[model samples]
Target: MPAMDTVVPPEGTILTERRGTLLLIGINRPAKRNGFTPRMYKELAEAYTLLDDDPDLRAGVLHAHGPHFTAGLDLPAMAPLMQRGEKAIPPGSVEPTDLGTPGYRRRGKPLVCAVQGITFTLGIELMLAADCVVAADDCRFSQLEVKRGIMATGGATLRMAERAGLGSALLYLLTGDEFGSAEALRLNFVQKVVPAGEQLAEAIRIAERIAAQAPLAVVATRLNALKAVEEGPLRAMGEFLAVQQRLSSSEDAAEGVRSFVEKRAARFTGR
Candidate 1:
C-alpha cells in the first residue's frame, strides 16, 4: 500500500492526498464526526472538481479522518444556506452530491467511498452518487431527514428508491431508522463490507484496480451505466453504441488489442 501524504486544505474542513493515479479526499472534522458545515461542502466540491479536471487522477477514494464517515448536515449552519437555495458546490465547482440546480454536473471519473461508524442523511446520499462503496461492518446508516423535520433533499429520496426498492426505501425513509452494513449491502446501497478499520483499505484497493484499467474505457463504462439509469435503457443503448464506435478508433484501443495478442500488460494513455 502506498503511504498517503495529507495535504492540508485552506478551509481546515477537508484533507486531500495523492496516491499515484488515485486521489484521496477525507472529511477532516473528526471532532464533529465529519459533519458538513457549509464550508466543508464547498471544500469537498472543489476536491471533486480537481479530481475531474486532472487527467493524471483516474479515480478517487472519499473517506473521513475520524472513526465515522459523517454525521450528515450541520443543520444550524446549513439551514441558512438552504433557505437561500444555495447548493454545496459554488458556481464553478463540480457537484458531488448531484443535488444542485438543473445545470449541475459531476466528474466523469469514478469515485469509491469508505464509510464507518455513523453515516446519516447526506452521508447516505453521497454513497448513492458514488460508483462503489465499501462500508465498515460497524457502520450504521440512517436517512434521518424526516426525524429532523425535513425531507431528504440530498438526492436520497430520488436515488434510494432506485437503488433500494421503493418499498424498502420508504420503510427507512419514513421511519428514519438506522440500518447496519449487512442491510446496506443487501439493499445494494454498498458494494462491499469489511471489518471495522479496514473499510478505507478496501476502498483504496478497489480504486487502484479501477485506476489500473484504461481510463477512457472506465469513463465510458460508467457513463453508459449512469445513462441507463438516468435515461431509459433504449436511449442509453444508442449512446453506448456511439461511444463504442468512438473508442474503437482511439490509440488506447489499439494498444489494448495489441497487448492482448502479445500476451503482455496493456498500457493505456487515455488517448
Candidate 2:
C-alpha cells in the first residue's frame, strides 16, 4: 500500500491516496465510526469523479480508517438536507451514489469496497453500488431506514433486491434487522469475507489484480456488466457484441495476442 500522504482529499472528511494504478479512498471520520456527514458525501463524490476522469487510475478501493466501515448517515445532519432537497455532490462533482440531480450518474470505472464492524443503511447501499466487496467476518450490516421512519434513498431498495433477492431483501429491509458477513456472502452482497483486520488488505489485493489487466478491457467489461443490470439483457447483449468488435481491433488486443504467442506478459497501453 502507498503511504497516506500521497494525495490529500480537499475536504478533510475523506482520505485519498494512489497505490500504483489503484486509488485508495478512505472514510476518515473514524471517531464517529466513519459516519457520513454532508461534507463527507461531497468528498466521496469528488473522489469518485477523480477516479473516473483520470485515465491512469485503473481501479479504486474504498475502505475506512477505523474498526468500522461506517455507522451510516448522520441522521440529525442529513434530515434537514433531505427536507430541503439539497444535492449531496455539490456543484461540478460526480455523484457516487447516482442519486444527485437529474441525469447525474455513477462513474464508469470500477469500485471495490472493504467493510468491517457496523455497516448500516447508506453503508450497505454504498457496497451495493460497488463492483466488488470484501467484508470482515465480524461485520454487521443493516438497511434500517424503515426503522428510522424514512425510506432508503441511497439505491438500496433497487439494488439490495437485485443482489440479495426479493424475499431476503424484504425480510431484512422491512424488519430493519441486522445480518452478518456470512449472510451477506450467501446473499451475494460481498465477494469475499476475511478475518476482521484483513478486510482492507484483501480488498486492496483484489483492486491491484484488477488494475493489472488491460485498462480498456477492464473498463469495457465493467460497462457491459452494468449495462446488463441497468438495461435488459437483450439490449446489453447487442451492445456487448458491438463493443467486442470494436475492442478486437485495438492495439491492446493485438498486444494481448502477440504476448500470448510469445509466452510473455503483455504490456498494454490501454489503446
Candidate 3:
C-alpha cells in the first residue's frame, strides 16, 4: 500500500472512496493497464474488509481507473505473491474474491462491477465473484491463464461453472479464447452492456438503487442469495423460514407494512 498520508498515485495500488452508501474501489495501475501488483492485491483485500465492516456502507463498486478494467496480474511483481498463495493476505484482511479462505469472510453486502477494454483472467474471475456486472460494449474477456501455462486459481474455476454452465466455461477456460461484451452477456457473465464509457455510470446507478432500499432487507436478501449459491439450496432453504421470521419482526418490517398501507415509500434505518 502507498503511504496513507500521501496524495500522489503510487506506481500500483488500489484507490477507495466513500460514495454516499457505496464504497467505490478503483484499480489504479493505469500505466500498467491497471494490473494488480502484490501490494495492490493486498490493498484491495483491505478495501473489501472496509466495505464488509463499515456499517455506513451499504454496497461497493469495483472498477478500474483506466480504459481497461485490468490486464490480470502484473506477472513480474505478482509471481512472488502467487507463490505464497493464500498466505499472501495479512491477518484480518478480507479476501476480495470471497473464496471463504478460513480467516476471511465475504462482505455481507452487494457489489456491482463495471468493466471495459481488456477484461481478462483475474478480471473475469473478479466479476464472477461479484453480484452483477455492467460491461462496456467494447469490452473483451478471456481466461488467459491457460495460455500462460497456468490455470485460474481465482474463483473462475469455482464460480464459472455455476454462473455460465460447465461447457461454456470449459471452452473458454481451456482455450483462453477472448470473447466480447456481447458473448459475455450471452453467457450471463454480465448483467448489462452499454456504450463505452457508460459502464461506471450504469454500475453506480444500479448500486444507488440498491442503496435506496431498506438496508437490513438488502443485506438479508444478499445473504440469503449468497447462502443459496455458496452452501447449496437445501441448507439455504433450511434457514429461510427462520431468517424471514427474524426480518419480519424488525422495526424496518413494520415500516414496510405501514408504508404499504399509506402508499408511501418505506424509510429503513437498518434496525
TM-score of each: 0.95, 0.93, 0.94
Candidate 3: clashing pairs of residues: none
Candidate 1's TM-score reads 0.95
* Model 1: per-residue Cα lDDT over 1-271, one tens digit each: 2332365343348778999999999888767777788889888988999999998999999998778889898888789988898776668678878554576666789999999999999899888889999999999999998888888987898888998889999999999999999999999999999999899999999999999888999999998888888877987888866798999999999999999999999999899
Candidate 1 colliding pairs, count? 0
- Cα lDDT of candidate 2 equals 0.86
lDDT of 2 by residue, 37-125 (tens): 88999889989999999988989999987788899988786789899988667676677775445656567788899999999988998
Residue by residue across 111-193, what tens digits does model 3's lDDT show? 99999999998899888888889999999898989888887988898787887899998999899999999999998999999
Give stretches of model 2 more than 4 Å off: 1-12, 99-101
Among all windows of ten consecutive residues in candidate 2, which has the lowest summed lDDT? 1-10
Weakest ten-residue segment in model 3 by summed lDDT: 1-10
RMSD of each: 2.2, 2.6, 2.9
Query: Candidate 3, residue 189: CA error in Å?
Result: 0.6
